[model samples]
Target: MPPVTERTSSLELPCQDGCVNVSIVVPIFNEEGNVGEFVECVFAALTPTSRAFELIVVDDGSRDASGEMLLRLAAERPWLRPVRLVRNYGQSSALQAGFDRVRGRYVVTLDGDMQNDPFDIPAMLDRLDSDAGIDVISGWREHRQDKALSRRLPSYIANALISRVTGVQLNDYGCALKAYRREVIDRIRLYGELHRFIPSLARDVGARIAEMPVRHHARTHGVSKYGIDRTFRVVLDLMLIVFFMRYRQRPLHAFGGLGLWLAALGVAILSWLGLLKLLGEHIAGRPLLTVGVLLLVVGVQLVVAGLVGELLSRIYHEGRGGAQYHVRDTRN
Candidate 1:
């Protein structure tokens, strides 16, 4: 888990009178060159809509002048709200901090690097509003502008693998431009690098998700924050998502099932050795006895772990007052 420190606002802000129609959250880290243009682009895209909206830019402890720029921008633009964390807590944490302060019926998230076009916001909002069933509208960069080998190729493979594992079937999990209904997003708790798996996490809670192709631009400032190492991180996070999806409620089923199979195999092996001993064959010096004993011990330990997991699961829900199921709505 990333250290979540106390957040301070660069400007003393007043709360909005009512819930705005839309809230846009962009996580910023060392993007001094793009911050000004990014704000301008967002305002250009949204100002004509005539719908109430707020722009939240979270500065994740940038070593550059990004924080200073945001402070100046927020002071000038009343709608622009800036959040500054004590230190760099990565993108996921910054987004969560922004999400916590959103006062909108609909939420939009995009990267601050300018690769994600803010012009796509209106179309996504339209799609989400016009359709009654869709709860999430994810942007897909079909014509990605990054290098094919170093950037796009690994992302392509990762998106496919994540889709297959989580059963969400999204074409671009890495794309940050996505629109979500407030109710659906409120149910989610962001931590770790799970922001990329938002669509999948929303699906787990019965959200109706859709994807559309959006514009992707080449980076013109600073440098790329990600590298080849990101692929490995994605793989590790994917495994955690799979575990929570399948066995979060009843982890005993996953561990105990494997334990039982190993214990049965161990029993079979030891029983064969006993039969050989009955036939007057030397069995004490055989390696099969040691293998059988090791299997039995490991199998028992796994079963104990399963029991412990069950206890933790109960405590987690009961302590947090969380229910195993979600209620979409209720009526008389």
Candidate 2:
């Protein structure tokens, strides 16, 4: 294998001629120990399916031998295409880079770690291909192999919260072994930690989603890159998903609702204080009066902020020629 910088900078692999059936995208981040075994398993599993497939391995600025290994693998195998990002921009960004470059009818995503089985890819692809109505098939790690307290518990809580908030219930939001139709996958863009909410975002765009049980294996490689610290980021992304799902087109409605409630409360407080003063009570220097005034000011500020949000949302859509609604089919 060549040096990481030289290989990554010069390597460029293109999809083979003819239509591609499936593009398997795996985002690797410092998974040098597992690269060889992972690729071997993936090839062994997909080869039997006899599908015109391409393997897109995104080397997310691994500070190890991972990039070099991928370059060597790509050099020998025409199916393996290595995409090296300039630096580590997290898993979501790496996945986005792969997704942007895929040229297949079906796009599948799985983790680089050996924990997620590559064999699940075939069944997921089959499910999507069998039903035109099913645009996305998510993997459910029914019997997760991770620690119950540290990973499984928080995942369960977060999955439940996401199901309720997005109304697109799935057993596992953290599973990376998922399959999606090319059109469905291309309809949405990813940012931050939004990759976990792909199904939810797809649902927002009228995608039909389903879940199936997939095999999971315990890690036997380099240290796990993820931890409980990601929970905070997941929660924040979930909130963004909820907002985008419901109020992405009408930003004013979400902000205005809270603004109205706060303004109403503030007005009620001030009215009560004014009535007390009119009834011969000395309300000067009262804490309630100060709080009421503060609330009124904050309420007005919130309303102004809501207006600004509406303007920004308008600019976001119109400036970029984006549409809030997508049409499924039309006949004259």
lDDT tens per residue, model 2, 1-332 = 11112223212333575567889999998999999878777776766676778889999899999999999887867778899988998888888999998888999999888889987888888888789889999999988889647787778778988888888889999999999988887898887878889998888888899999998988989887766777777789888888888887777787777877878888999999999989999898899888888878877787888799989888988898788788787999
> Model 1, stretches more than 4 Å misplaced?
1-17
TM per candidate comes to 0.92, 0.90
**lDDT (10s digit) by residue, model 1, range 161-256:** 998888899899999999999888888888999888889889988899999999999999978888778899999999999998899999889898
- Candidate 2 overall lDDT versus native: 0.84
TM for candidate 2 is: 0.90
Question: Model 1 — TM-score against the truth?
Answer: 0.92
Give the range where candidate 1 is weakest over 10 consecutive residues by summed lDDT: 1-10
With a 3 Å backbone cut-off (N, CA, C), the pairs that clash in candidate 2 are none
What's the lDDT for all of these models?
Answer: 0.87, 0.84
